[model samples]
Target: MRAAVFDRFGPPDVLHVVHIPDPQPGPGEVRVRVLAAGVQPFDVGVRQGNMPWAKVEFPQTIGQEYAGVVDALGEGVRDLAVGDPVLGSTMLNGNAELLCVAAANVVRKPHNLDFPTAAALVAASQTASGALLELGVGEGDVLLVHAAAGSVGTVATQLARLAGATVIGSASFDNHSRVRRQGALPVPYGEELIAAVRDTGLQPTAALDGAGAEAIAQSVALGISPDRIGTIVDDKAAAEHGVRVVRAGRDPERLARVIALAAEGKVLMPVQAFPLSEVVEAHRAVESRHSHGKVVLIIEP
Candidate 1:
């Protein structure tokens, strides 16, 4: 099998494509023939050693989420079968031709979704959905999504709207129209952001900080309930600021909902694809912090 392998991680340039041994499934697990892999901010952070809190082994294969077919199933796995289309998350090791995943971690891909969209949903979309659930957002509420044009923000805005919330999204002027297209009232992110949202007379009842920017802290200062604020960025100051976080190892139910929404075309994933051999470029694109969508790797034809 060929994979993007890195020894002593430093930057995206450290990643190289090379032949590696094929992984096998264990009991209650399945081996997926990877079709598409989602590149997340965590993937880049793990590769560049920015997440010192997370200990990763050397020669790591970095990827967080993927979509593929179950080529083989381990003993005790009965709900799935050979050739089942699935999307899932792994603590590591998704950026390859095959990955062994616990049966519980994998879900059948929505019948109407393609592999790329399925792959993109697990990480970003799920986080967005889970955040909205945590904040208790619903119909008639005003929800504000920071960096709403990004991968998670885009899905979150749509999900909020679908849940009947009035949604406001902050992005650069360049992406305002795109956010509006997703059913969010677009507000330009910067000094004028708060006022722009205020002009609409929508007092935000909840907030999701996908931006990881200083502006997020400022938003919290505007008097929305701290319990209603959550961030995917895992900023250390969240607790002190009375904000919440969506961390690793959450229950998979929120993710499952996001997958269903994608299949139903109620949610969207803007994604850019690169061949598996170009994993480094994909990482660079993610690290650039200007990607308008999720960056993904096409691992199989």
Candidate 2:
């Protein structure tokens, strides 16, 4: 199997595709023939050696989410079988031709969702859904989503709207139209953010910050209570502001629900894709922090 691996932590160029021995599924596990994998900001941090708690070894593979077909099943795995299309979260080995994961962690992919699209939803779906649940965003509330153009923010905004909350999304002028399309009243970010939300005549009752740059402070300025404000980014600012830092851990059930919504066209995620050979470029796109959508690696086609 060919996998993207890095010998050292540095820049995108450090990632290279190389052949490695195929891995076999253990008991209760299934081996997937990877079709697509999502590249995230967390991967960039891993590549740059920014995450202190993450253990890295030489020639390490890095990726978190993938969509693929089941190629093999290990002992005790019964609910899924060979050739079943599935998507799920993994630790650090998604950017490969094949991967083995626990069957319980995999979600069946809907026929309407393509491989890349299914892969794209893995992380953002879980994160956004968990954040909204934790913040108790619901009817008659206005939800402010920072970095509304981002993957997590995009899903968060749409989900909040579906929950009957008016959404105010913060993004640059370039992404205002896109944010608005996601059911958010688009507002410009930075120092003018609070005023922009006020201009929209929406009072934010809950806030989800995907963008780290003073978003918690801005949410506070908008009169949102600290307990109602949550951040997935900038834990430091979250602590300083006494706001909640939402971990939004991965959950297969939550991911599956969002996937079902995506299949029904209630939620959408744009994918910027690159071939597996161009994994370096994929990493670069994610690191740029300006990609219009989720960045993914096309591993099969």
Candidate 3:
């Protein structure tokens, strides 16, 4: 099996592909022949040695989401078969030719959703849905999403719209049109954001911050209550502003719901894909914060 691994944490260039023994499934686990994988900011942080709490060792494989076909099953698993198309969350091994995850944690991929698209939805769907649920965003509420053009933000914008909320998304002017297509009234991000949002004439009742920096503080300046402002990107700022720091934990059920919506074309995340041989470039794209949507590696094709 060929996997992306980093012997030591540093820049994106540290990531390299190498052949290793194929991983075997344990009891209740299933081995997947990975077709695509999603790269996240979490992966970048882990690679930069910023996440001390994450377990890491020399030559650690790095990726958190995968979509592929099942090839083998382990003991005590009877719910899925060898040909099942699955997508779900994994840790440190998704950027490989194969990975083993608990069968109980896998979400069946819809036939209409291709591998790259399914892989793109894995983390962002869970995070965005969890944040919206925690924030109580719905009808009659005008919601502001920071980094609205980003993976998590894009999902958040679309999901919030589906829940009957009017969404205002913050992004670079270059992405304004893309954000608008996702059902948000797009506004430029950063120092001028508050003014831009104000010009839209919609008062935000809640805010979801996927872009750190001054998002929480700016949300405060916009007259939104601290209780209704949630952030998945900035915890320290959330604490400083006395707002909610959303912990978008992994929940297979939550991911499944979003996947179902995606299958019906109700939600979508654009994929910026690179082949497995360019794992380094994939990391660079996610780290740059300029990728059009979700950054993914096409591991098999």
RMSD of each: 1.6, 0.8, 0.8
Question: What is the alpha-carbon lDDT of model 3 when measured against the actual structure?
Answer: 0.94
- Per-residue alpha-carbon lDDT of candidate 1 for residues 139-204, written as tens digits (9 for 90 to 100): 898998888998988888998898999998999998888998999999988888878988988789
Which window of 10 residues has the lowest lDDT sum in candidate 2? 292-301
How do the residues 140-204 of candidate 3 rate in per-residue lDDT, one tens digit apiece? 89999999999999999999999999999999999999999999999988899999999998999
Q: Rate the local accuracy (lDDT) of all candidates.
A: 0.84, 0.94, 0.94
Question: How far does residue 283 in candidate 2 sit from its true spot (Å)?
Answer: 0.9
Error of 3 at 69 (Å): 0.4
Model 2, residue 96: displacement in angstroms? Answer: 0.4
Task: Show the colliding residue pairs in model 2.
Answer: none
Give the residue spans of candidate 3 off by over 4 A.
Answer: none
